[model samples]
Target: MYDYVKGQVTRITPEYIALEVQNIGYQLFTPNPYAFRVNEQIQLVYVHMHVREDAHTLYGFTSLEQRELFRKLIQVSGIGPKGALAILASGAPTHVIQAIEMEDEAFLVKFPGVGKKTARQMILDLKGKLGTLMDVVELPSTEDELPLFGMNPYGHELEEAMLALIALGYSEKELAKVKPQLEEDEALTTTDAYMKQALKVLLKMK
Candidate 1:
């Protein structure tokens, strides 16, 4: 029902961000909630609404291209919304598109919950369909180093990053393997930074 939401980010949690508009808060589950900063200036978030008998959910993205890629992902067999979110959480939609186009099942299966069968199905279903999105897919920086920021004394940033990864279907066991490393990395001060580093570690573990 919502094409986009224009509002200030009033709150952010591991699972979702609350965009307050007209005295109401709309909870939007995104691939990366930390990508948005709380109390930031008003912005437009393109949204996709998924409705079921049990509940209605809204998945938000920074751009329409991201939303479109998400929509396409969910249509693939064996891939649900959460799985799609996990794929996007890598922050490398360009890489995903390249994998799909190249029929590289190895790259696609690296994401949590994606098996070899699902990977092949994704290629069979979406290979030629994603060409248009390639031009618009935002390529994330290839740098291994992320910008540093002031650390939260309570360690809420790292905790939130962990929770977001769990919500994306990563197991606690997998996170346990990386938590110490994340805590030890002084450069990861912001939740976004922690998330990026954690994802890199998790992908490497695969």
Candidate 2:
């Protein structure tokens, strides 16, 4: 029922970004919340509404192609939203389509949850149908946005970094243990730098 919402990114969680538009907050689930920065410009989240028996949900994508590819992935048997997200997280959609078309079961099985059987099913179900989609599915650009040094000394970037860590599989309890140490450090400008620092702190926390 909705096309897109344009608002400042106020809160970014592991699985969602809360956009503040017109005194209201819309929490959008995206594949990568780090793609957005706090207090950044308004974002246009190309959305897909997913309705199951017990839940009604909205999933957002950075691009139309990502949304379309996500739609196709969920159509395959045994592939749910989480599984499809894990596939996209590898940051390689064309590779996935190519593997499906080529029936390269080994490549498909390499993803987080895909085993031999699921991989084969993907090939059987989606091989030929993905050619048109492949032509349009381009990976999002990977250029670093902001610098790594002397950015948010107040721990804004550090907080965002922790959210990203959770998205990458770290738990809240784990992040909490080391967050104070991270805040004790200097400010970081870019998200990438914060990610690196958080990883280091997490390793030391272990």
Q: Per-candidate TM vs. native?
A: 0.69, 0.66
Provide the lDDT at 20 for model 1: 90
**Mind sharing the TM-score for model 2?**
0.66
Q: Per-residue lDDT for 1-206 in model 1, tens only?
A: 77898999998876789999888999999987887877658989999999999999999998777898999999998999998987787535666776777677766776667899999999999987886797864443443212122332326567878887897899999999999999887556456778889999989999
Question: In model 1, which runs have C-alpha deviations exceeding 4 angstroms?
Answer: 137-180, 183-206
Candidate 2 local lDDT, 57-167, one digit each (tens): 877787777777788989989999878876765444666766676676866775668899899888888877875687854433334221212433234446667777887
Q: For every candidate structure, what is the RMSD over all alpha carbons to the true structure, in angstroms?
A: 10.1, 10.3
**Best of the candidates, TM-score:** 1
lDDT of each: 0.79, 0.71
Candidate 2 regions off by >4 Å?
A: 137-206
Native-to-model Cα distance after best TM-score fit, residue 106 in candidate 1, in Å: 1.0
